[model samples]
Target: MTSPRRWTLRTENTGYTVRLSPDGPWAELDAWGPLGVEDGPSALDWSRRTHFITPADAAPAEYLPYGLRPFAGADLVASRPGEERGVWWDFEAVEEAAGSLRLAFADDVIGLRAVLCYSTVPGTDVILRWTELTCTGDRELRLERIDSAGVTVPVSGPARLTYLTGQWSQEFQHTQLDLPRGTFTMGSQQAVPGHAYAPWLAVQDGASEAAYGVALEWSGNWHMTAEAEPGGAVRVRAGRVPHEGAVFLAPGETLTTPRLACAFSPDGLDGLSRVWHRYERHLAGERLRRPRKVLYNSWEATGFDVDAAGQLELAKVAADIGAELFVVDDGWFPGRADDTGGLGDWYPDPAAFPQGFGRFVEEVRALGLDFGLWVEPEAVSPNSRLYAEHPEWVYRIDGRPARLVRNQLLLDLGRTDVQDFVIATLDRLLTEHAVSYLKWDMNRPPTERGRPGADHADHLDLDAQHVAGYLRVLDHLRAAHPHVTVEGCAGGGGRIEHATLARTDVVWPSDNTAPLDRLSIQYGFLHAHAPHVMSSWVTDAPGVFDPRPRSLAFRFVNAMCGVLGIGADLRAWTGEQRAEAARWIARYKDVRDVVHHADVRLLGTPADPTFGVQYDDPAAGRTVVAALSTGRLDGAPLVPGRPERLRLRGLDPRARYHDAESGSTYSGAHLLHYGLPFAWSADHDADLVVLTRQ
Candidate 1:
């Protein structure tokens, strides 16, 4: 019998060769071509290549080079090229287990070292240190620098870093770098035009200045490769400038670069690291159980008019429907019994629940469902208690009141007091209630921008500061809670970044709950992220919000591809509708393990008239195929003729399987090589086929 040698790795660049051995501790890495080669044609000379051009010639200096320098305080000298020009510097690697590699070089003019460590996960994390020394008239000088430039600088300085550490592929490039998950560029910078600098220089009055202003730029990219074994092939290419880092040396100064480190593992330690962060940042680890599947929410059902009895009624229906979680969405907080009042107050509204929130939570738990509460903690209503108490906490314009979004004001998360207040409030809620899940929400953009107690002229940069503060708050939450499953919601899908994903277990794909709408959106999202990270939920009655016939089924099917949950009122569903939901839920329960763990195959592309998603459940020895026809010819038979047989992938050919829908039998070879036939009509645009090995 031939053992499964199903996965293979290759690269486009011939300069590198990767060897995989089952017994080797790591895949072998051999030198590939002299990539980034310039036969006098520099790497920066990509103007002739259409793929390199941007909509504008001067692309924003989003990408930059950042590194660390060692012996920052030392002075070094170099000889001229050809006349013993090269200078040498020696340094020792500290904590090799930290995974950093350092290299140094020196010449007649300058001495330098480059330390680089690529992470094994999806995110940016490259640490660099650079040091240089020069002498003038027998005087020695030392230079040290760390690239902590702000994001506005063309060099990105770390904000634009993409999460791409891990087994990743870029079209023809393959890679298996040992990268830690969630590692991302923390700082970067790019050279601004008309401001380039040349390393050649002289010293005057204690300062050694160089000629030629060079453009320095910095940007971060993400990567995920299919290569897992050692010696896996990968290719990388980057544009170059007129000169890399070159330093001018006086007679006797030495320079050093910062030490670099990175760790990689086949056990997915990087991903686990990010998961640990997500747990801590979102306070999910403290809640020992995974979030429940069937969740009932009051967003559509109650809106802002939620009373104790109203909540209890919904709780009863949720409990009866076997829903595991019930969330009291918007309008629960102080002065918020209606939409007009109470923006920032964290206290519960007395009118809505006369008995208080603790009693309400007890009542809900008594009905056999866990309680979840919604909080737009980042936004404050104009009439909220907190807003009244600390109006200065809201972002406001000079001599102007704060602008409102959805009748809310963006909270100033930059202040330590603000962060501490939010943390304390959340901690109180978690400690006081049986809250298992949190629908953490952000409803507004930063508008008014003023530093508290500062004059109107001292306004802050709202955008950058707010974004950074949001990350800080998320980090604080995760560190503090560590037990609750936090659901990130940015008015829908606005904040879908790798950093956000690293801090939260699930993200709402969008407020557009229609299954058809979600299919493509989810597809686009999955292109860069894992499917399990998405939270796809059912919401509202079909015609009320969505006018599609199979709205329910469509939502269910779309959500089946990700984490499953419901946000609508089950009590409003008829017996038949409830039964259908129950059946679908059971079906999900039957195959969720496989769907979550299996390798996915996109059978058809959107560019094609038809779209399909297929999953091969190796553990269950089953395969499920889902297809949707976007455009169909009129008068086409209800069941189209000669259905295209799909050449399925990611399956074991030796396994025998029987179709769940048709009882058709076939081996993996017959199913994958020959393909499966799917019949459908224009009205019935979507179909699902499941095959289980018998």
Candidate 2:
């Protein structure tokens, strides 16, 4: 027989290979990671393990197929008459281009065609995969489960599943579980890529230092399922959640799944994480190089009591402490005394800003700081003038009572008028004000999500479309105002995802500024996202929510790990505290480039409350490690036997390094193995160690 077709895709230190048999139509993952073979496994031999009657060579194991043959986990599921109500795509053609591969499969029986796309970058060990399905038949078809990508992992022993789980103030807490014999599924149906669980998953065998993972690039409700087949093999599939209903496709109609990013690592979880960070950085592109200026937000400091004079005082102190951007949040708008009013009214509140924002902007600029404003265009307050003027603009049924959260109702952005108003208002704001930044906050979830004319039952689809419309406005606004930077905040961090991050410059990790609580929150966050785009603020030491007072140094060090911002009421600070903060701000500037551009490694797991993260910039020849003690550092140690030393990684082992904090010199080997002693001298004490290669 002719040699079976084989292809190998290599990325840095990893490789992915797929094998196809001339006699069979299925595409099997021959090898992944370091074990990937360059030459063909052309024999197509399975006699060594086969027990039942062997299937046709054309129908080998499928990585992405419907209930055709004995597929483990189908990537595409469809129904048609006379065919067991499933899709069976026959292999047609395969094309390879620069750093990309395309495979075409068609099921003439149902007139459906499937095209799978795969691509990889130069320096990262990740493969981006997504599928496009086209209907060529004259009849309609129902698509039940269409996944972005599907891959089978070869397992020799027990495998563990690692995923993220958290809620509200806390997000991306990593959770691991041993694979069971049945299907394990996780996703978000909350209309937003929620805080409860991140859209990333990995199946790893630490024993072999082998792992396979995938992250979906979708923002709305999505699903991922890992099925452990009867054998030791496991199949993973991911895509948008079809909870609304099976999507109906008419003749000549086409549908595309969200891109699913997959990565393989032979160096365990840390390597896999580093690969993901690099991939995200590559995706971020120019944003990574753009300076993430230290910003000062007047939310925790002033709340709804915003005014020009008070803000000017805050802006002076903020600029004094090295803040580059000054943002007035919430109360700047007309009728916006609090969350209950002044949402849709995008204009400045004439009373609070008697001189208008132009004066405030000019004063802020005079202090050498840029200006920003907070706006929630996707929502309307029931008490606002905009609501009274355009009641039908908000999401509601003709007779049903409008559901309110945080005294606000969600605007149906799916409507063209809403999208137009948002674009025009934001464009005007950028055109008129010298505003350099915008804090876009979505404080509430969608309720009564139906359009004015659409049926209530179709609201789920409307929710999905609303998110698209929101993206459209952002796209247009960004295109029109390229100089303006936007920060995404859904209350806090609720709207963080690949889809939203594509347009916004930064994301608010959480609303909770409590340093102690943020330790875990930030740790969970970096598991899937990068640090440069994560907006962290050093609010008041005693935090608005968690009243546990922490040292200024502790708060500063903790917040310094990400895009540093200060939200505290600086006007109330003592002279000594202000001096101390100035020093820390200077220190953060000293390391901001390294922290933002380096490869991030989350060093500790959630079970270990005393976790830390390391940032390494090989080109800059420096590394920064920030370790935090989440529990009480005052009365008693929470973990009585917690390790006092933190062994750093991603360092050049042969080089000599200088510890700037201790003014001590040590070999890289010593720092890697012996580690620096974490002197948790006080309650909630945080430690930051900067190592410079000498």
Candidate 3:
């Protein structure tokens, strides 16, 4: 009964240890030194008590180990009697065994360092990639790779220095490195510019469950640009530069990058396209915008009691089933919503829109669609009105009063006027309506609160300073609504990160609108995110609580793999289910620019009875396969083969094709050796094979 050894690494002189072998691969490492003994006798006070060791283990009442300082041009150089000399340690165990486990520390002359990686990728959730560094002592360094759910990828060239940070957990989280251009002066003070290392990474199924490792994807402020080559050498480029991936460095050399974290177990999309090609090569030179209105919601369709003409009649049946955005979930907000109460009162509920929310955003933009709203804005409702006009903005413990879940509380996002009233009430509802989209949500689970004198094992550094004040209220709503479009709903797949997808584009993912639970939660959120940021919809077909009707071609083959929403109500379907939901939302708006920019291939197994295909052809030699079937078995009769002759991978394999779903086509070697008849049914369902190349 022991197949779980996935990973482990260890080191010490006051720090370093990692272990994860509960069920795959293998990892175990340990290094140690300083423990106790100090009696004040010269030799630099017995070499600072044999180079430090004061961690007696306690912290973790919900995590708060923010302590370890010395990485900003780290220089101690030599110590023994308990070691501690320039300090160096590194760790990584990610061949996508649910990507995570990256420990690092650096000393020996400044280049900033204090990083952490902790994802446990099961259904693509888990985050923590916090960073605060400042380096440029010249040896090359640049890394802007933020993941674990807050997407920012960009890593420029030349980096080689390794491991810094000297000391251990005092409830960790205090960083300050300025590296004014490097030279050294920690005695007369002035040398405070670059060098601060306290690195970490862990995701070999990160501690397992708790809804998968509590959010983090390179949390907050990541930027390191340096250049001073030719001898004193210092060349670095890190990414997320103006929004695109980047990485470049030079020191002792070691940069393997690509670890967004994933795990579906029932194993499908396994390693999900190498964690979506390391988050699309750290968002390789950005520019891919597409979310003016790609939706499908229904609180799972009619859950909280819908209303407001039953949600404008399900936004005119999701704009006659083609939908271009029409949200409206949670019974139209205000003190006492259907779910219970208007969580954190963002307002709007003159009896569920008796004319207001700008006339329900001009009647869902006069039926052409394009209006969305559903906010949690950090949470409040203890019968709200901003918690009865600020009950010290929530997050308590001092006098106790702060424990209520779902009926709600939370809202003390480490206060800065509660991140300026959640960025001025979501920028006054995107400047009084015409709202383009928001969703947002957060639900709960941060618990109690402590940081006012810390010690309750330091409430996870005040919950990472209220998740860096909810990313400074989403960088002030993307600097005041850069053309709306939010999404990001926690409590439903909880805040998947890369720092909340660099201020969100889309997420929602789970209210479980059954298309077989979104084909196993979007094959585990397209393994680390970005199948047009996955949202998925089409609800209310015998799945209000599992009656099992399914089919609408297995719910548009799992809402055509995402960003398509329609929470059923189109005046109650049935015109052949509204022409098969407007012919699969017009074939997902004609292959959504190759499913929001191509390159994905899975084929089968979420527990294989066989039926799971996903191929995309980005222009040059066109191709697109989707197939499905994890149901039918034993009755037999469902066998339709012809992936033309299937064997395509990244395409252009000598072009020449044509089967935009069967006009008879072949080549790319007869569709990669003729193997594509996917017939495994509970009445015949699931298929999406488009191949073009006249």
Candidate 4:
């Protein structure tokens, strides 16, 4: 007889509304779409439906606990020592503060409280949701699983899910499937967010262009499970610090789950990408103002033979070719002729660098290029003195042989002593040298993740503690040495997420830098992350994933799409090739601002005969399109046809544009309708075309 109580949340362009069901205090999503859609009846209200599951289970509640979410999986699972694994919670209070909304529920009998939190990511069509569980009872409770938030998409018919999946060097391969029924699950348990799958998902209503996206903001083990309900609603639940068993929660202590960002886009997956990009840029804030530098890393050139004379030689050529930063990769530490040793030895190898590390850095600075170094701080090799002295620091299960991944053992970062040691190591290096950049890489996930203590198996929240330690070190770097740029890498693209992105300047996309393979990797990466944070390298490796021998220009254009880096051995390149790289670097500096800050649009995928990334900067009256021909072509004609053109979007039709290369002019209307013509052929496989509004 009485109308249900309701609450509506809105971002710049979208809206989300939830209401209390008439039969119970539990909430259900009423409306979630464009602005001004909050006044209608909620499609997920259980009061309007008939039969099936419990009231809380049937209703599309925002967040529910164990006993309440009976038949279905609960967002929060908890239990006391000898009690049943469930809770009968009732709505207690709702609070709104500082643009954030919170709803609290309490189970008086169990002495537990759950708070669902929501806040809009300012200036964007995205809202972040998370949960906090507090132990209110006198006895401690165990939390087996606590998800950030449960999102219910108001969909009819089936839901199409889009996600990224792959391994190690071949990460971020976009994959999609239609789910007419049942549930789909994806996650990582390898301590760090593993390479098998990323913690992100996008759901579309059948074939509609409108879509909803969810991304978990966590660097540790996480999970995302999406289910297509029988009644046509799609529900997604995600969280972090996923453990095999319950983690103890003491009285008066509160555990907060990772934030799950929910976004809405009306223009399709491409448009949804812009929403995510804008949010990431917002997260960067003042850091976004800093330019993405063109760097030259000396990893592929001289692996373990990192001597001062050889490094200085490479630095001279790097400076000549317009590299702003010069990084000396691994194998620069003592006892480190190969990957088998010298991991924990942080000091520069005296034998390899007879001219002192500081002097080597000064020599690089004299060449007009900033100095950088690579360090893997969380791993220890048995051959190193640090590990030999403190072998207990490495993670190991008692009575079990230690597992070695990449010939190194993972440091138990959960220990405060280990965290302090890592901080001291990086701090001393940056303070002693004039290092402008630091490439922090993690080569492998923790294999035997265990603490040496007896109580750790059930009492210690190892994953959560390790993540906190990692973030603390990165935060220390950002605050203590603001001048240093930090590049985050975990065997390439393994540890990328919002929490890591907040503290680091850039992330290595993958170890597979082959032209076509990298293009595919970057294509999927840009959809979820901003380009400024994607560190792309032009390497001469003989194809780790793709074997196609693409031209130098093709490699340059592909790497230019993100923060450009050169890892090829410069001395091995021909004079003409060196000259060509210099030209491309010069050209890149001209359009780097637009490329980094502009709204990026992925024209087509690498699978297409002709695909490109279009950077549209309307405010600056400029657009840079790095078009590439991936498929086979002939001089007589482009693979598909000379008539094939890339129709541009998000431009004013009345404006006229001038092409920098051809010196030709065209109306914005013409470019939007017809598009930029690509003269693709055997000789010209790729072109970085810049256009200025006239």
Candidate 5:
């Protein structure tokens, strides 16, 4: 038998092929989808050249040896110890394992080795890629521009790119652009990921269907580029951002880049998103088995005026409405009446909680709710006790002043004392109180990221070290207090990545809980993260900045799509409103399991007059669809022209499903082919449809 020219890595129900050209230039991704080839190898060609076009206007004119090639993104970009020319690597070896493949390449002249690694989860289409570079020569290597991995897809007709961009309070706004054969890029060098661009990008075949996507798993500064080559082929490159400084490696030293996950789907962008959800659950391991509590956070209700009596009143109402966890956010800490002070002081305000957290915890527990506290361990207000005692603890350049963001300076996690302080403080809090959950908030990025006692030569990369230190603190807390769950919130959605997700049980996508605006925010968030980890809250009407007065049902239905939380001030609600909220909470509990473990599908975009999400768990034989209608402004009573029917997806066509609400049974074939009629009145209407395999 002849050796296969193309090798296939078969995943769950998808196949990805790596083909080597007969001319022996480079290995290219020939195909990636449900079928290995859409038509034939000739139709989906992979015979493109590996070299760059000479003096191209879009790229460097000098033809940087390791830069933009016609077929694939550069895997490695580095020069010798004292040279400016990038090393030219030739493919050497390929190895295959259980669910992984490793490709090794080498630069003979410079004696540098580069290895490209690819791995996939057992039952998902996501292919993870990363790079390892090492010097085999007898000299040191100065490295710059090292990307984890890159892949290219050939387009047939009109193509478009979909991505997300937003600010602090308005994060994860879904946006798209027509692919007109140019380079599109997003990156962050602010020491942490930015609110403007999420580390994810998708390329769709015009109709916003049949898509391919890539998401970087790094938490530190990172960059992702999607360049549309002239001939309808788009290449994507992503990895850690080399913004701090160039890396130097002595002979025999090796550096590994962060993992970049790529997936393809024939069913559209929603299908592609489902694969990511599955992959994340697989990584979540035991955490997936634990049921997420119906949390009630008191941040919006009692911002800085948190007193024991106020929290107790909220906890009683929260428990009455089925909240299992009650979190006191921000104001509980000493001197923390406002954002400008008391960030580093992690203890309860002496006057507010005269007896400390003991009585408050007992009261919340007495109301059948678990207690939680908010802490900004990585940030310090200059006026606080922690900063006043150790001013050198904050990140700062030798003589320059420490820059403040949100009236706080980022603690130099690189220092042993600072790290110790964070860990010890958290350990004491968890040990002292009946705190079942922690709202870990890092409100700002590192500024003047330089340490005082450390030498510049060795401690120049303080930002990266700070990230590691932050992760270390979480690891320690998890080990020390296994029962405590941490919710990662970096000024609302700023610190999102696979690494951070791995440590925390949940993430706050944004502080803005206005139901109308959140529809779009949640749409973009779920594209890259699992719904179980995305924290969605239902607060009061006429949200913070948005003037839309959404019905309580609309807010509950929207928040139910994720790990549901109630941030509304139940204390002020009428008896009828409280009863209604209780019923919604009960309904959420009925399908919480399915919501947490199911494969989510984005039913329609926020741009559509009707927006919603569908959760389907084939194995569990459960399906839940939550749809919200954008009603017209004219105070019309009835839903304008009737509600649009929702077409069910991910159903077994031959099986039967029974709708609980209508008490009707329908064939899976009919439900999948046709859509179920939704009942609603006026606008801003919301409904939760539940079905079971029967």
Candidate 6:
């Protein structure tokens, strides 16, 4: 027998090896880590203690069904009408490429074939994995659980897990915990990926800096569970459209699971973030390097009192403040006097734009700025004309009452008819106004989530359908309206994933823009995602979430860390504040390229009194740093004996550096060793320092 074959998949710096023995019915992950790991004895080659349970149950099974691995949790679960739930599949065939692999397993009796798919992203340390299930028999099969991939991490004892979790106003809070035993799981039951938790997980040995990360690309209901088996092996399983009963698989019909992207980093979670960012940029393609304009949004300024004159006034101030794109946020549509109405309506309110919507958009553009608009396409208020005309378009059970959150019902995006209407609505708006930027928002999740007329309501898999239809519409936007830039938001950071990042130019992190609160939120966000896709805004100071007094300079530095946007009502700003905003905006544009496309390192977390981010680009000959004092400082900004300092990273020790703002020069060795000194006063707590290497 040909030794069941073994394949090693290589990314830029890591290697993952899987083995299938001719004697066993299942495959196992032999090794995973640095490139040369497979050249030596696999760490998994150990003595087996499989006395009571089968080898498939004791081994690190890649992906298995119930019967063969009856003890452990299974990856695939299926059943025939009058048959058992177990699927005893046998390894059948495999297809391998330079950086890709596909393993097939078939259960002849059940007439089902499952294929595990794997491929490496070209330029990054990321491997995308998914699954394909084909029903080969005449009778339809019910698929209860079909996961994308099963990841096995070999460990001696406990493993550490890191994930992002938070709620509506406070999203993307970095969380970490120990997985010493049992199973830890996180997921979203809402039709959309809710604000509860992001579909991402990272596992590392105890305190080791080396980390392995897995993120689901599906923006629908999903689950990621990490199980630390009794034998000291940690296994993670992830999938989308989950916990919703089952789906019917007819003969010859195949269902492809969503891709689960896997990444590795030797330098820790911070390093792992760059891996994710690189892959996101790879996913973005041409949109990656595109200039992210300095934007000004008119939501907090005008609110529902939007009108032709008020917006133009704001536009003049925005253009004067160096805003490249001007966005008219919510309350622009008819019937939208408040959040309780005018959600589904696509056209602009004639009363607000009596001069005509087309002319208003052109007028905003006339101020040397690109015009933008915000729309929540997947929601409908009871008072909306679209909802009144097509009440059946929303998700609802036949005779059940619909629950309304935020006075709106989520549209059934799964339906092709609904997708068509959404596409048509957005296309018309973009075409009529010649809009250059679009902010697509979804305010609520599905409550009923039912298709009234479906034959097998239990097997509908509404989440999958909705997600597919949503991606379809996004694809149409990319193809048909390629000239328009898109920003994705689900209330705020609720629906962020690779799929959304691939399609949209940026995403809103949170609704709370108070400096200190937003600083922590952006800190957690940059740990898991890249800066290019992060849309940070500077709103009014000392408002709402955090009432702590913060300088406008602090607010600008906080927002400038990402794609800078001024959400504050500039018309209300004093002349000094407006001038300061213009200066900061100009400075951001000067170093925006390095900030967006350079090596980023976060120094001292929010826990430290002075924490900030460093962006370094040797090719650009620029190194920018934004340091903010989050806690109380001692007497004197520049203490005689102990000056507040921040040690820089990724700098040559022997090189000389010049400070653009202060005309100060120092050795890179001294800057990196003793650190750069900050003379921050009580009112001046933050600074954006630019350094040029000489």
How do all the candidates rank in terms of TM-score, highest first? 4, 6, 5, 2, 1, 3
Model 2 misplacement above 4 A: 1-4, 21-24, 35-65, 69-71, 80-84, 397-399, 455-460, 541-548, 605-610, 631-643
Supply the global lDDT for candidate 1.
0.48
Q: What is the clash count for each candidate, in the order shown?
A: 103, 8, 111, 0, 4, 0
Location of the lowest summed lDDT over 10 successive residues in candidate 2: 53-62
Q: Residue 421 of model 2: what lDDT?
A: 88
Predictions: Cα RMSD each = 14.2, 3.6, 19.5, 2.0, 3.3, 1.9
Candidate with the larger TM-score of 2 and 5: 5
TM-score of 2: 0.91
Clashing residue pairs, backbone N/CA/C < 3 A, model 5: 631-683, 631-684, 638-682, 639-682
Which residue runs of candidate 6 sit more than 4 Å off their true CA positions?
1-4, 21-23, 541-546, 637-641
lDDT of 4 by residue, 513-566 (tens): 888889889999988988999999888976677787888999999999989999
User: Can you write out model 6's per-residue Cα lDDT over 442-475, one digit (the tens) per residue?
Assistant: 8888887777777763467788888889999999
- Write down the worst ten-residue block by lDDT for model 5: 55-64
Comparison by TM-score, 2 against 6, better one: 6
In model 4, which range of ten residues has the least summed lDDT? 634-643
- For 1-694, candidate 3 gives per-residue lDDT tens digits of 0123223211111111233322212122221112111112211111112123321111000111112213211111212213232223222223322334543344334343323444332322222233323232454444433222221111122222211122111101122232223321110010111112212111111222111111113332223333222222232222221121223334444433223332111112333343443353344223245443557565656766655777777777677767777777766665553655777777677776776778777987898877877888877777767778887777776766567776776776767788888888888878987887888877665467543343542213343356668878887787778677777765665445455666777766556566664565566455445676676776664543334466677777677765677776567678888877788788878876666566666655444544454546555545677776655355354454422222445455576678766677666665655555554457666677777777
Model 3: how far is 195 from its true place, Å?
27
Per-prediction TM-score to the true structure, in the order listed = 0.63, 0.91, 0.35, 0.97, 0.92, 0.97
Q: After superposition, how far is residue 62 of candidate 6 from its true place, in Å?
A: 1.9
Q: lDDT of all predictions, in order shown?
A: 0.48, 0.77, 0.49, 0.87, 0.78, 0.86
In the range 516-561, model 5's lDDT, one tens digit per residue, is: 8887789899887899998999998466555667788999999998
Our tally of clashes for model 4 stands at: 0
lDDT of 6 at 250: 88
